[model samples]
Target: MTDWLSASAMLLAGVIVGAMFLYGMRRRQDRSDLERADLEAKRDALIARLREAPDPSLERDAAEVLRKLDKMGVEAAPLGGAAGGLKPAATQIKGFLWGAGSVAAIAAIVFFVTRQTKPAAPADPLADLERSVQQNPDNLPLRDDLAKAYLDRNNIEGVSEQTQYVLQRNPSDARALTYSAIVHIIARQPEAAAAMLQRATQSDPNLVDAWVGVAWLNAQAGDMPRAEAAMAEAKRRHPEMAERLDQLMAHLRGPSKAEAVHVTLNYGGQARGMIFIIARAAGVTSGPPAAVKRLPLSTFPIDVDLSAADSMMGQPLPQKMRIEARIDSDGDPLTHDPKDPGAVAEGVVLGNSVSLTLK
Candidate 1:
């Protein structure tokens, strides 16, 4: 942007300089013509004086007029001077060059200064969004958008981070679990893949994809009975989704593929208390009202270990999976704040939500 402004300033300066130089040249020519006319008038006055009064005083007066013409820088012949008007001509030439040079220098300085003062161009919105996500990875809405951005760019690293973020919220998140399982399976980690598949099933038994996951894991292990059983269960639960599930299973069993894998949510990393991981769909738009299940972290300072790579499967995290940690205070939790809402930090990222007291 700065470069563009500089170029534009240069073009404008060139145009302005050209115009001023042309005008200056014309003005100098006009001034020269006026001087010539004045010199001619003085000469005619002297000739008339000599014709009318042939006096010595008149001759001396005409000599003074000629001297005044020389001071006025009129480049004309003196009445009988040996050297013509060389001195006045040199003065006019020097003055014009000095004036033109000064104008050019001033124009150049103005152009550069204007260019320097111009504002810079705007930043990329997507790049800004990515940076925001990196700084605050636990922001689910931002993370979701970032995940799609990574998908568009085919950036596996970004995809992994975003998927891990979703899992951090709700370890049992079906989409996250499914993607994580796919990633692990492609990396030849059948045990890890099976674990995630089991997590998805526990979160939502109706999710046929989870059963497919189990089937794929079992098939890779040469356990056809468990594999077939898992497939049958998937068919029974999701009759409509059976065909697609089979296609997916077939693809997973194909030739080996490289994958960028990451660990599941780590529940033991909970700082304050037992942290919960919630996983929502990759692009979930809206959720239910503020119940214990869908409570925003602002109202409740839950110490959810959001960045945990593994999730506890003994119980379901949450149906919607927004809150991660419940910082179990020693006593009964506070209900309301007396001061300003802005003074009390509400729903920020989980990292900022850690505290034993409301403050």
Candidate 2:
């Protein structure tokens, strides 16, 4: 989400800066045009006088003056259409446009490259998993990546697909069970994740991740005391797991840490409308992404740090995954509805996947 926002902000800034630069250049050219016009008028008057004069000496002086004026006129002609013709005017306009476009392109490229090279946002469990999947899509370890991304994003569409896939193989996979519980919890299903975590813990107490997941769920329900106890117990039983447990505690205390995802959504071809970004758990009913966040839009597409507890099943996210980036209209600034304000723009896709390295 931070990645999407940051990219959007950079794009907007580039456009504004480019526009300003072009406007300034045009103003300068306009001023030059006016000055050239005045000079041409003076040159023309001198030429006319030289042509009408009769006295030999006076004619000679006028001719000399006319020559000087003609030379000055030639030099200034390019600035206006005086004598340089339409070709010069067209060339000047073309050069102005090309120069402006080149500068804008260079600046935009620099900004984009910088954004991509930066580290990921804070550790969003969902983002981490997405990262993992992107890094190792074929590496089976991230088989659960898509599901987790959707779960974290609260995407209601593909939960069943993800859960079904996971359970099909590891019928008793703790991660799958925990996610199912999370689905219930997010759906307001009343301690669904807790119940699953409880069963999983009893069946396999060593599943520290499951314990962490339960603790987070409890914390979300305002059961702070229960959440703390759960985390403490997990830490005590597996001292080596204390680090992971600590992360869970922090996340339950507030929003999950942000994970940076440097992204560029080029809506290839002639597509219309602006893109709307949203981040919801994979299985929830949350609406599309929006600016409901408190931060200014300009601060987006930034790196967000995420804690370990931000993951889907209390496990680290795989890597990079393509979170749903809804391509829609960005309506008028004065209007509120962004979904269908009736405006559209060209769309281009710059590779449909995140570039992640597999372990």
- How well does candidate 2 match the true structure in TM-score terms? 0.32
Per-residue lDDT value at 343 in model 2 = 20
- Name the runs in model 1 displaced over 4 angstroms: 1-12, 15-130, 141-169, 201-359
lDDT by residue for model 1 (167-272), tens: 8787767756765675565444567888888888888888765686677667656576787788789889888887876655554343221111111222222233
TM-score of each: 0.35, 0.32
Q: Any runs in candidate 2 off by more than 4 Å, and if so which?
A: 1-142, 149-159, 168-170, 251-359
Give the worst 10-residue stretch by lDDT in candidate 2: 290-299
Cα deviation of 54, candidate 2, in Å: 85
Candidate 1 local Cα displacement, residue 236, angstroms:
13
Model 2 lDDT tens row, 44-143: 6655675786567656654664455465445533344545545545655565566656665765686678777987767767767667766875544365
Model 1 has an lDDT value of 0.52
